[model samples]
Target: MLSAGPTPRVSLDTWEFVIAAENGTEHRWSWQELMALPQETPMVDIHCVTHWSKLGTTWQGVSLDTLLDGVDTGAHFALAHSYGGYTTNLPLDDLRGGRAWVAHTFDGAPLAPEHGGPARLLVPHLYFWKSAKWVRGIRLKTMDEPGFWETAGYHDYGDPWREQRYQGD
Candidate 1:
């Protein structure tokens, strides 16, 4: 379990995730709103840059494609921001289609705070760090911007299969 800062206490009544785009368009969704969307349980393997891998983990949440539906943007990349100020960057392509999810449940139960509770971005195909925990929003941009770890020496695009961990790995 890794965290950027103290865990945030969120209330279902006031908590909402905001998606902001460079075009000045922003969309907000509450917990109930998100749950109302089509959900899926995907069994995926997660690899951490710290040299650990967890396979066949099941997660349930709304697909990024679903949340992004009708959102028009020419951005080529996205920056995932978390409650505790953690952020990660990825190509917009990595989040489209069925490639990513905003997961709220794990192993058939509500996600625990220690594991990025309320909701977390799950991009299983990339290194686990790219799956920003405590995810709160996504900012789309036309140009690439290195995120927290990326600016701190981690690779800007963390593709696990390619072992892109460090800046030049």
Candidate 2:
């Protein structure tokens, strides 16, 4: 299991997932609320920037499309924020159209805290780090903004197949 630092302890009854728009609008969903939405089981291959690849991983959660349904925004990018002060930026296109999910389960079990429990952003098409753990919300932006790792020299847009690991890679 991978974690940013010490695992965060969350209480199911009080935790929530939020989605904020560039227009100053915000939507919040509790764990039960998210579970009530449409859920999908996606089988994906995850490649870590650190050079490890895990194939055929199964995840179940609400699609990002479903989560953003009916929300209006002219943003071209999204910055996913996590509870542990971790963030990752992705093009809005990468997050929509069934490309990503707010995943809560993995391998037929609830996601472990060390692996980002409660809910995490799952963008399978990009390197695993783009899938921010302990995800709490997404902030829409009309302009791209470098996130935590990106500002730390990781590639702003991490496409594993292209091996975009570092800033100049």
The whole-model lDDT of each prediction reads: 0.90, 0.90
Residue-by-residue lDDT tens digits, candidate 2, 1-169: 3355787877789878888999999999998898999999999999998889999999999999998998889999999998878888999999988889999999999999888887889998999889988898999999999998899888999999899998988
For model 2, state the Cα shift of residue 66 in Å.
0.3
lDDT of 1 by residue, 71-132 (tens): 88889999999887898899999999898999999999999887987899999999998998
Please provide TM-scores, in order, for all candidate models, with all chains considered together. Answer: 0.97, 0.96
Candidate 2 lDDT: 0.90
Q: Candidate 1: deviation at residue 118, Å?
A: 0.4
Clashing pairs for predicted structure model 1, backbone only: none
Q: 48 in model 1: Cα distance from truth in Å?
A: 0.5
Residue 48's lDDT in candidate 1: 93
